[model samples]
Target: VHIIICFYSIVLLYPQKNMPQQSEAIVIYTGWERHALVGSDIRLSCSFFSWRWTSDDVTFSWSYRADGARDSIYVFHYTGGAPYVANKGPFRDRLEFVGNPGRRDGSILLKNLDYGDNGTFTCDAKNPPDIVGHASSVRLLVFEKVPIQAGVITGAIIGAVLGLLVLVVVIYYLMRFLVARRVFNLSVRSVSLCLGLRSKLQLILYGLAVTRCFFLI
Candidate 1:
């Protein structure tokens, strides 16, 4: 009787001990914003991190809210190694699944973008026991021509400055070499003139000595 009572007491005290604990929440990552020209293609990148092991149960979802739209709408869904793209949305035939769930990526490629496609895109992911986290969002801007990025502009300016500096250095070195060559030529000419004058003076002195010897004889 005492054994039965003790077993019942233990069961009552720790009834949830054998239950599996929930894992850490999933963390979704995405780029802040992207720019693409109209009629071009772009990749909306997304990935996730989860404490639980990745499995076939991992799923991805994409939603979109057009500029100034009040509500967002689902555009793409991925589960069980298959994708279900919306058939009658702004991204109807333009969305492609470019991510691998096993690798924790949920990115999608947007093709033939239009100005109407400028909007915010949200990426949500779920990995079984790690399904509790906020989704990541990225903004897309479609333009007639993609604006130059600040980094690109800075790099161009830096390259131009470097090229100018290199040209200046080359010119400076070339001028120095020309000046040095001219100075060498002038020194050679001066040395040649001095040797000519010395030879002429020696001949004149020898002729004078011969004249003096003739006079003495």
Candidate 2:
């Protein structure tokens, strides 16, 4: 019997050291003009170019302000995964930390948006040796539902249509009345001329008959 040898092959799924290239600074992946419906949730994101190079002790904070001169309102804060602070400010009960700090994600969730929530939101993502360049900002817009607007618009359209129809009907009747009155006036003028002629003829004939009777008597 002959001895047979088999060669084994190994495939590397993940690299042992796959460090992403460092970026100039962290970037907020979420868009700027973030709009949310009232009583809904909105997610604001902040992160660096590479999570692998991010620090585990990174700190994330979110703040908001409706005016520039007023003090910033704290929304949320976090140091790492599962360890965070939903501030005792306006958004205490409605803030959620949905970001993955292990992956360098610093996104926060704001729930049950209100009228006062519409303002400029700022995110701070601070890591060791890179604390100064991890800030990003976004604006939030909250909208409410208006049930009466549709009815008001529909009523305006229907009222316009009805008014136009009434105007058309009034014009039609007015023109018809004017035409009928003109015809009636013409007919009356002709009847008056005929009656005048008949009266003249009857007077002349009566006079001629009286002359004849007188001559006969």
Candidate 3:
């Protein structure tokens, strides 16, 4: 009788653990804000990182709001093993499902970007009990591609300056070498030829001036 009572007491003291209490925490990682040019495409980066895989009851929804807008527009949604896209918004037929929610990939592709599409994008995911940290948002800035990129313009200016500096340095070294090595040793005949050329140039100029004055008179 005492052994039976002890067994019942042990069973009462140690009960089964609740599954919710032992569930792993969720962690959604949405990448940083992206800056893209208009008329170009961009891939939204979103992935969940956790020890446990959320393969069951998976759902993903994406929303966006313009820079000065007060309300967010529903962009895309996926649930019950199917995908739904925005049918009335500008993103209709623009959102491409490029991620696998079964494998923790919740990314998407935004094609033919527009200027008004510049806004904050929210990526929300849910998998039953592991749903709190499954939501994250990022900002996207779109601009006209007609403008030059700041990095490219800066690089071009820097390259031009460097090329000019290299040319100047080469020319300076050549002149310095000629002076230091006494490489410009001109013979008597070379000096005579230079003087002859100078005198001929002066005579030609004088003749041209005289002809101009005679024509005026």
Candidate 4:
């Protein structure tokens, strides 16, 4: 009697490429110039582009220059199973991961922008050889509300300046018209004298000259 035994082997498969990828991307973190006024809820974003993606366990880090201290602002680690987020400080809820790891668009978004959140930001991915990117700054400027009285005063000043300009222009035009009319009246009188017209014609010309003068005045 001969006995035969059959056995089957099972193989597990995953994406072969599993390594920390190195990428470089830059984002306009500050989004505002120094001393510029900005409103609340302004968003802050940082990007990391144009870097190679290797199959190595990687960690992403965000840093800021505050009070002359280089602190770990936020950290994201990519283990084999799932992504892990390490809470650094102050950015527990304000930071958002805008890009997915496999896509390599490592960008972050920060919301509820505040004046205290102004400074230069340094972002990098922690692969074997650190892949670093830096933003000039990330500024959260606040716009102060204009006082009602101050606004009124400024409006009144501008109105007064415009009124003065208009008055000067009107006076200039009036002077020019008067000089032209005076010359014209002189000519009219000389012609009347040379022609020696009737009293009625002289009276009519005089009435017209008086009407023109009255309107000008």
TM-score of model number 4: 0.40
> lDDT per residue, candidate 2, 1-217, as tens digits?
1222222222244453574534344554545667678999988877665333667677787887874437787777776544455547778788788888777787888889998888888887766545546467888888886234566899999999999999999999999999999999999999999999999999999999999999999
Model 1 clash number = 0
Error of 1 at 208 (Å): 1.5
Error of 1 at 114 (Å): 1.7
Winner of 1 and 2 under lDDT? 1
Pick the TM-score winner: 1
Task: Candidate 2: give the clashing pairs.
Answer: none
Give each prediction's root-mean-square deviation over alpha carbons: 3.7, 12.0, 14.5, 14.7
Residue 65 error for model 4, in Å? 2.8
Winner by TM-score between candidate 3 and candidate 2 = 3
| TM-score per candidate, chains pooled | 0.83, 0.50, 0.59, 0.40
Clashing pairs in 3: none
* Separate clash counts for every candidate: 0, 0, 0, 11
lDDT (Cα, tens digit) per residue for candidate 3, span 1-217: 9999999998788756532434566777787678788899999977876666576778788998889999998889888888889897888988988989888787899999988888899988776666667468899888775457588999999999999999999999999998866644656568889999999999999999999999999
Candidate 4 or 1, higher lDDT: 1
Ranking by TM-score: 1, 3, 2, 4
Error of 1 at 7 (Å): 6.6
Residue lDDT tens for model 1, 98-160: 988889998899999999999999999999878899999999999998899999999999999
Q: After superposition, how far is residue 87 of candidate 4 from its true place, in Å?
A: 2.2
